[model samples]
Target: MKPFPKFARQALALMIASVPLFPVAQAATAAEWPTKPVRIIVAAPPGGTADILARIFAHELQSPLGQPLIVDNKAGAAGTIGVHGLLSAPRDGYTFLLVQKGIVSEVPQVMKVTYDPFKDLVPLAQLTRQGLILVGKPGLPARNLGELVTYIKANPGKVDYANFGAGMRGHTMGVQFNRLAGVTAGAVSYKGSPPALQDVMGGHVPLMFDGPATSLPFIRSKQLKAFAIAYPKRIPALPDVPTFAELGFPDLKEVSWMALWSAPGVPPAVLARMREATLKVMQSPEVQKKIEDLGMEIGSAATSEELARDARESSERQGKLLRSINFTPD
Candidate 1:
């Protein structure tokens, strides 16, 4: 080859030197994608099971992301508002949503959602799946599901049930249960289970369909009376409470659940890293015990495809459940 000019040789050497370095810097940036604080949006008010579960995952996630995790509470509109907030944020992996599957699966059916949940939010991991309990105020005229149904039949719209959000698990279960029981009762929506259950406990609301963990304290204290669990079997925490399946409602065996999600189009490498870090956190004995103590079953084995499939199926099923009760948002 012809000899290169002096300036051309210097320029070629400089280009060769830096070509290798840019990728190194890019790789470093990729590895440390979350150099700033990460936010995990909880779609309900604080002091609810979703909020509690989000905090647990957030605490464990800090070490994985190498950045402190912030829990952002955006409670309203039966969780639709929070979903809007999540989608409005950039699709960067740093912003995640820690919410119940019901919001994605159950909420969209009753009314409308601005974005397609499955398409807009990429499923990361399923954290916990557990049964919700049906509890009534301490002085509701009925002691069991049968009596409660009879009371509702007799008293129709005079009684009300509390739910954290419209079209969520508690809402769907309550509406479904009433349909199967052949009764009519009104529902009151709240920002979270804590507030809704509080109304039930204070006798402001007649009954509530809520998470086992959120209602456990009140059930233990006798502020709220546990009528029946929405699981296939009874829980050790409340051995006396009969399950809906045991009480002749076989279709009521579904469990309420929560999952972690990232905004759409997260880099594949970052997605894999997130999956690995989450699985690590989930596999820890301490985290498992902590979740179990909260009356939730760990569901870390679920894959993203499975999560998405389940969401679609469950949304249709819940839509039917709501329709059976003639439920339509006003």
Candidate 2:
């Protein structure tokens, strides 16, 4: 048989080279997936929104993934600990971190963290968003945002507000309130919202900025008076209560969000799967009602690419805000 022509030889070589790459790519894609239990690291202790959402998501993902979904709470250091834990895990899509908006956006700006929020992690999806409610003891004079602002102005440093921690979302809101409303208030920190809320309910602290999960039950029982929600629009759970914008402080609107992220370098296929699983869980009626009942609004489902972009934008904005305010971690 005559030897192959030059063009045919080149074509044969190209086909041989392509054959190995196909299986290599297939193997990489297959190995990129989770073959064991996947852990979702929550940045707060049990009973908190991050933890609760993680558990719900784990349950929803288990059946589809054919693997157990575990939640590991590494609460401390303003969520950096949990983030560190997630970062330390393998990047093979078996580990994820459940984080709030503040942890990704604000905490890094104020604190020195081991991992860069944007560079070290890949965003999966934003699961929920909720407005914080400003609440006070039932007998306090403030009934709405206006009343609260006026009272704080009159009282100045005398109006004390308890928060989960110094640099937490609640405390950040307090700083914004003081800056915008031109009123000074004392910030008392607690280990978490439950204890801080306890202080508020017992009249030890007259005011507090609390999440709906912690504040809603009290508001319903008439123990705590709901002032105004820190959101652009009023939430249906507290429809009667006005938003801060309605009360003339549009800049005070802040919506807390919970999101899922994986360590950077997780394969695109794995990340896509995670995003799909998270959106599916959040869209379910049962999960929707549970989140809504907790006083949070379900977030718009986002693709992995969209979530990654949001994380970057939020981090940049938060860095600017913190630097402008000269905020430093404690």
Candidate 3:
């Protein structure tokens, strides 16, 4: 091939110099990421634990990210709607999901969903893990799990417990508790925690298996009576309460966690940047105190691979519980 003319060659050299090196340009873009507002999708409705946590994290993360973080509530269908919304959003790292582990692990096993969570999403960081609390309406005669079991046996067909949803952690725990305690209480499924909790508080439902996020306030205010908590140890927020293990039902000590996830295919640099910002915010003493006050434990500094493996193990355990109960969606 003939060589380019002198002027043309010089112009080409100038053009090449004007353009940034690809690696440097990419690093810069990742560094200045989230130039615009970002969104965090919550799979549950307002007033629920997940929504509250999402708002808290969003508010705290804005300063570190240098952009406003918006929380989008896409509730319904056992969290499938929110999961779908996250998967459908742009993989540009501007959109993310703040959801409970059940949404990806337990929900899909029982509900019909369009996407596979492991394949469609990548974990950024775990936000928090909370244990479930068994609470009763103020008027209930039972003050503890033992009394509750006696009451349930006495009432037989008349007694029932409220669960946030079928295949959810609360429901699973309720079923296991019934079998282990040798009681015959049935489960009443609600669309979300708020409604279920409201019914229990109203005395329309005598009991509910709920997360501390929503139940703690009522229990503290004496609107609801604590029976048993499903944590391995008693939480600081409710130190007076006995754990399920303490109540003689060690198998009921299952805890559910929440985590942040990015859409699949988000660039590695963007994922790392986002994860770093999230972990920094989460590790702060102020943030940790805030989460603990809400009756949740701050998540570990687990990487995405570690988080995924944990999720898979949680899914397997939930699946076994579902199979044992022969659970079917209604």
Candidate 4:
């Protein structure tokens, strides 16, 4: 057998010395991940859109991750507080934020948030798209969009509307409706949709822009009249109602989507696993049925790459709209 040169022998010894380190390093990386219970922060109080979505995901995440998913409700500041809290956490995929589309796309433009929605957050998956339903008080004499607009125009500032909260989807829709229709109404902000719906039903507020899930019961009971849905198509729960597009307000049609997001800098492997788990959970028949029953349309979960692209596109579009309206946080 021939012997190697001195430099070659040193190189061979170094390679042999480093042979055991690779597996150890990889195993350590994987082991360090999710060493504790993972936490999903919901930027709203219990029973709201973000909270409900978080619980749904937490239930599904447990089976795949083999770790209990903890849902932390840090509601306030129009979802910015909870979102900022999640962004402040370690970017190890153990912490995530589940929020509605308004927060990710529109709130930043209207509010002075500490974190940049696009730059600080990494997209995970879009779970569902819950279209907003324009509901009027029973016996208010507004049967459809045209009637509602006519009534509002005649009444002017006499009309009152309830919103889930400031800068929320409901509020944004109200603002958009007033802007496009060239009419203004008193906007009453509540903690969540249920309370807002209560006031609307009680005639304290005559109308509201509500998510399908929150307004479906009232609509079915005929306590509230759904004039039009803000999406391109009518919600299944309110098939009889027309859409904004059908009523010549195509620009008002916007789907309120729910998505999961993690802070930037999470490892690619962790993100991949999270994304896979999300898609599987979202596609499950059990989950799908529950989502459908809530008046939400199921959407295909996106990969990290796809999510990134969507975030960029949404941010750009929302920026233009915000600039047009000269919207800013108070």
Q: Which one is best on lDDT?
A: 3
Tens-digit lDDT track for model 2 on 126-236?
Answer: 888887888999878866777777888887668899998766678778878888888888889887799889889899999899988779988999999998889878776
**In order, what lDDT does every prediction score?**
0.81, 0.81, 0.86, 0.80
Model 2 stretches astray by more than 4 angstroms:
1-32, 316-325
* TM match of model 2 to true structure: 0.86
RMSD of 4: 4.2
Question: Stretches of candidate 1 above 4 Å error?
Answer: 1-29, 32-34, 141-143, 146-160, 186-192
Candidate 3, superposed: residue stretches over 4 Å from native: 1-24
**Model 3 lDDT tens row, 1-330:** 999999999999998997878778878877789899999999888877788889889999999888999999998888778888888888878889888777778878877777886888677898898899989999988777788888889888888789988788888888888888998788898877888999999999898899898889999999999988888888888889999898789888876789998888887888998898898899889889989899999998989998888888888988898988787754
List TM-score per model, in order. Answer: 0.82, 0.86, 0.89, 0.84
Q: Write the per-residue lDDT of candidate 1 for residues 160-237, one digit (tens) a residue.
A: 889877766777787778778887778888867778877888889998888888888878888888888888678767
Off by over 4 Å in 4: 1-24, 31-36, 179-192, 316-326
Which scores better on TM-score, 1 or 4? Answer: 4
lDDT of 4: 0.80
What is every candidate's alpha-carbon RMSD to the true fold?
Answer: 3.8, 4.4, 2.9, 4.2
Report residue 91 deviation for candidate 2 (angstroms): 1.4
Q: List clashing residue pairs in candidate 2.
A: none
- Clashes (N, CA, C under 3 Å) per candidate: 0, 0, 0, 0
Ranking by TM-score: 3, 2, 4, 1
